[model samples]
Target: MNNTHLHLVVNHLPIIFPVVGIILLVIGIFTKTEVSKRNSYFIFILGALASIAAMATGEGAEEGVENLPGVAESLIETHEEAAELFAGLSYILGGISTVALFASFRNYIFSKIMPFTVVLFALATLFFAQKAGTTGGEIRHTEISSTGTSQIIGEDIKKESNHHDKE
Candidate 1:
């Protein structure tokens, strides 16, 4: 409905697509299949595009959540920083994928070497994606947050008791 909602919808794309890409790329390399590797590159390109969409919607999402009673600005900021890094990695992967795609189609010598670099990039992207996902979860999912989990549970219990007393 809103930017924040859109952000939530699209955020997982950046995380999940790379995983599929990595798997496909590995399988392609192992089996000597150009089509699978090309598909992997295409997925990486899609993931990079999704990362852009996510980042575009992120500021509004932050605005929506930052003032919520249990949300922390610090967590949002951390997530933002992590998202930036993740997006950068995606962009780099996209570039490599493009080059590899072209090289593969042309049967260039570089295509043979591209998979190793792609694996490195994919691993790096995967690592940052995990960090981004965790930090993003903590933005609103207080139960999973490092600092606020216990406090949030305590607050929930207190609220329940207060409601019972009033009833």
Candidate 2:
């Protein structure tokens, strides 16, 4: 409905993609399957695109949430800082995925380098994802919230989750 809403929708992709990509990449490496490796690259590239979308939407989301009851500006600021790092990592990893994709398709000369690049990108993605996840959790989960400025949203999440479990 809104930028924030769309952002929430797309935000899950970054988390999902890198996880799936890592699994695929590992499987590919173990099995020595070019196809699996290529698929992993494609997923990572999509994840990068999703990260861009999430970042763009995040600005509006931040604005929307900053003034909400129980929301703390300080926590939002911290989240913003982590988000910047996440976006940068996504772009870098995405770039690597693109190069890897091209190399895979063309049977290019950089075949040797692609594996190493993928490994690097995968590691970077994992780090960024952790940072992003922690920051995002702080948005509404008070106990986990590190902004040190906002009321905890942990109860809210717990209540909501409990309610869902009942259903």
Clashing pairs in 1: none
Each candidate: what lDDT?
0.92, 0.81
- Looking at candidate 1, the ten consecutive residues that score lowest on lDDT are 142-151
Best by lDDT: 1
Tens digit of per-residue lDDT, candidate 2, span 1-167 = 98778888998798789889888988887888889989999988898898888888999998778877777777778778887888788878878888898898899988657866796678777887888878887777767744443334465777789999999
Q: Note the residue pairs that clash in candidate 2.
A: 140-153, 142-152, 142-153, 142-154
Task: Write model 1 residue lDDT over 99-156, tens digit each, in one string.
Answer: 9999999999988999889978899999999999999998778778758787778889
- For model 2, what is the error of residue 16's alpha carbon versus the real structure, in angstroms, after optimal superposition? 1.3
Best by TM-score: 1
User: Which ranges of candidate 2 are over 4 A from the true structure?
Assistant: 146-167
